[model samples]
Target: MMIHAMSASALSQMDQPAFVAALDGIFEHSPWVAGRAWPQRPFASREALLDSLVDTLRSAPRSDQLALIRAHPELAGKRAMHGALSAASIREQLGAGLLACMPEEFALIRDFNTAYKAKFGFPFVIAMSGLWRGDIIAAMARRLAHEPEVEFAEALAQIARIAALRLAERVAD
Candidate 1:
């Protein structure tokens, strides 16, 4: 495992591009999150560093926020099946047992993914840690019924959880 053994102070001292690179894969395909939060440096602790990153997400414009949400691949979607997921995403999904789905399980999640994207206009975003395929499918089914606004908020919240997990995995206090 590639663990980033830097403290908050070390990370705060890095240049913007370097900072972004260090945290590149933490926010799905959106390195801009770290790019934007670079100004809020001099973090007091690991928790504060994570807070600044997530705060960037919370305060972003609707379009940018939607872009971040859209940037995440669907759970057990085509990307996972094709072995094309990013390293962080692959690790998380593999831990969730998503990388080895059975044919029937794949078909089931494919249907859920199709319905989810059709309904929400973005892929379903979940922090797949400690979750099972059945749990994911149940979440997809339940989230499919959420109103657009509700589901949108839920997606952002889920993405926040993912970021926290990624940061914890890589960076130390």
Candidate 2:
């Protein structure tokens, strides 16, 4: 196996603990994701590190994966309303126009969250980095109809996308 090095200057220099600390929130509240990926460092580039992060997650047991998925807060739900989200999540949701939803749009999201969670046993996961609220609403409605297994896979994929975006922003290639 080829072992590569971390490319982000600060990240490249960190010991395992510090490195995990720096990336703790990249995968929502799952710092263990970064902790697991640290053994594979130094990553050759940011993308490689992100791949490792996603790979670590993909290798996890189903229960662990579900836990990671459930760790995310609902978009425009109680967390957003009460400022309980992580700083990164707040910025991401706000940028996606979730925090600016008109009353009707907000209610729609609330309804969707309720229905989606009731179906899948976890929050609907999406990468809202550059998406508008309408896009999110449409996707949520469409995804709600997916089979449980399909939706579970899709949720993991979306989480990877979110983690990739967050990691990219934090680490320069």
Candidate that would win on lDDT: 1
The per-residue C-alpha lDDT of model 1 at residue 87 equals 90
lDDT of 1 by residue, 19-47 (tens): 99999888989999999999999888889
lDDT of 2 by residue, 61-147 (tens): 999999999999998999889999998889889999999999999999999999999999999999997799999999999999999
Off by over 4 Å in 2: 1-6
What are the TM-scores, per candidate, against the unseen true structure? 0.96, 0.93
User: Model 1 residue 78 lDDT?
Assistant: 77
Which runs of model 1 end up more than 4 angstroms from their true locations? none
